[model samples]
Target: MTDTSKNETNATGAPVTDEAPNTASADVEALQARVAQLEKEVAEYKDQWLRAVADYKNVKRRTDQERADLIRGASAGLILKLLPVVDDLERAMNSVTPEVYASQWYSGFKLIPQKLQTVLDSEGVTPIAAVGADFDPNFHEAVIYEAAGEGQGGKVVAELQKGYMQRERVLRPAMVKVGQE
Candidate 1:
């Protein structure tokens, strides 16, 4: 008669097969979910790194522009303050008559101012035109108003103090008398 026991050995001495363990499928699914989550995290970190690099480049560019502007303004400020002294020297040169022009002292005085102006010109300091030109509030400051004759309104009558510019920026505004209709 055959044995009634469920556990039996085959001819090769291996145990008889039964259903697979219930936890096997569940463990495989959990591993796949973990892998997906790790991939998403890696993508987020990559995006953050790209943004940080872009921000650093932008900040560097802005700082460079500001520094260049500061250097330009420093030079312009020094030149603007020296313009009045230059104008006075010019007036003094003009006042010297033909007799005075022949004197050694007058010649030295004139040469000094001319040489100084040449140096200033090399550094990008330049004068603004004020006489007989149309009034521009950006470059001129009206110190006095005068009654304009025919065809003279809105014109610069006289310059009290000369203005100057460095490159494209106005370093000093010209002090002037304006004519009005």
Candidate 2:
């Protein structure tokens, strides 16, 4: 006897229907869409992580720079306080008479200033060239405006006090006598 049902039998006598294949294809399509959505979310999360890492590196670099700047400022302050002592030593050495200059004590005393100057030089402290240069308020403080001499108009004729620089920054401005027309 022949079966009258729409279902057909496979080799193992199991009933097969066209609707079964369509249902399985629909499930596969849903699963593929879910996978695509997950991939997009993962990409977004990865981009956020990279940006966070870059921000952390920038903050570290800025903090390190600030620390170095603070150290330089503190050292500059200490050097400012020592400049007067250097001037005093220079004055004392200059006033010594020939007789006193020839003494053993005078020679030893002169070495003190030389040693102090060496230390300052090693720390990047340098004297500003004020004499014979054009008068500028940034590096020279005009203590007296003197009458111009030959070819000395608007120039620094003499430095009453020495000026110093720490690296590129001005530690002190020179006290100068400026010549005017």
- How many clashing pairs per prediction, in order? 0, 0
TM-score of 1: 0.74
For residues 1-181, could you state the per-residue lDDT of candidate 2 as single tens digits?
Answer: 7654546787899777767689889999999999999999999999999999999999999999999999888888889999999999988888999999999999888889999999899889999999999999999999999898788998999999999998889999999999988
- Model 1 per-residue lDDT tens digits across residues 82-102: 777888887887787899898
Give the residue spans of candidate 2 off by over 4 A. Answer: 1-23
Alpha-carbon TM-score of each model against the true structure: 0.74, 0.83
lDDT of 2 at 55: 90
Best by lDDT, which number?
2
